[model samples]
Target: MILALDVHYKDDGSAKSVGVLFNLKDSQPKEILVAYLEETDEYIPGEFYKRELLCLLKIVEKVSMHDLEAIVIDGYVYIDNEKRFGLGGYLWQTLNEQIPIIGVAKNFYHGNNETVKQIYRGKSKKPLYISSVGLELDTASDFITQMPGEFRIPHLLKQLDTITKEK
Candidate 1:
């Protein structure tokens, strides 16, 4: 089973952010994990990760690490060799290392668009970039493209996104 996770922030309030998880079996999602920030808490002392990371960790804790095949994260990673580790790094560190990881972001470093990226679902298409644990950029894109689904977005992640907010 493969897992796809994503986070989207609400502009009106920080508490409105949503975290999404998609459990895939045979290239199709069989489970979904949705985490949201309902209220802001006092900032935790950290330069890379903030209160948002705290809430995200709570969501990560819900997964049963044993059954997972690979975990697909929803954003970019800023690794600092000097810092030892930070929030983004910790999020994955908390997970079972037996399962591999992949991080997909809608937007990446500025001017990174030189690398062609496109998500095709029926007639609609969108651009995406992915940084995975063991896979290269080309391999990551190929993995997402091969996922069997009718939507441009992965079926599970898309479903969780809709459920997290009023639409």
Candidate 2:
């Protein structure tokens, strides 16, 4: 199964809300799981993973890893071309690098390495940034490009963002 994950933070940044959507390959999501967590760490510059990782790990603990084929996150996998680990990369390492992690970002990150792929979807002139660990870059890009939706963002990913914010 494939899972898409996203986190929404309270306005004051005191709490984090997380959403996880599960889907089979090439299919719409079959389930969505949400979690709320108290923020323990401050959001430090260049250290976003610290805050978001806690929220993600909490939600992930509720699911069986054996059923997880890949995890799609709403960020980058690398901070720069130098291969620095981003939130997604940290998650992959924390999980022992067993499950593949794909990072899809709506805005272009200036710090992103050259390895990140730019993909345009629907009729939007803007492109989504795609990065990955445990899978080839092109393959990961293709997966997101084919995700269920005609607009720029995939339906399931947009759903994740909506559900996360609703919490």
On lDDT, the leading prediction is 2
Give every collision pair in model 1: none
TM-score, per-candidate, Cα-based: 0.62, 0.93
lDDT of 2 by residue, 1-167 (tens): 88788887776655555555556444456777777765557889989999889888877887889998899999999989899999999999999999999999888888675869999999999999999999999999999998878899988888778877774
lDDT of each: 0.53, 0.84
For residue 158, give model 2's deviation from the true position in Å: 0.5
Off by over 4 Å in 2: 24-28, 111-113
Output the worst ten-in-a-row residue range by lDDT, candidate 2: 19-28
Q: RMSD for all candidates, in order, please.
A: 5.1, 1.6
Native-to-model Cα distance after best TM-score fit, residue 134 in candidate 2, in Å: 0.1
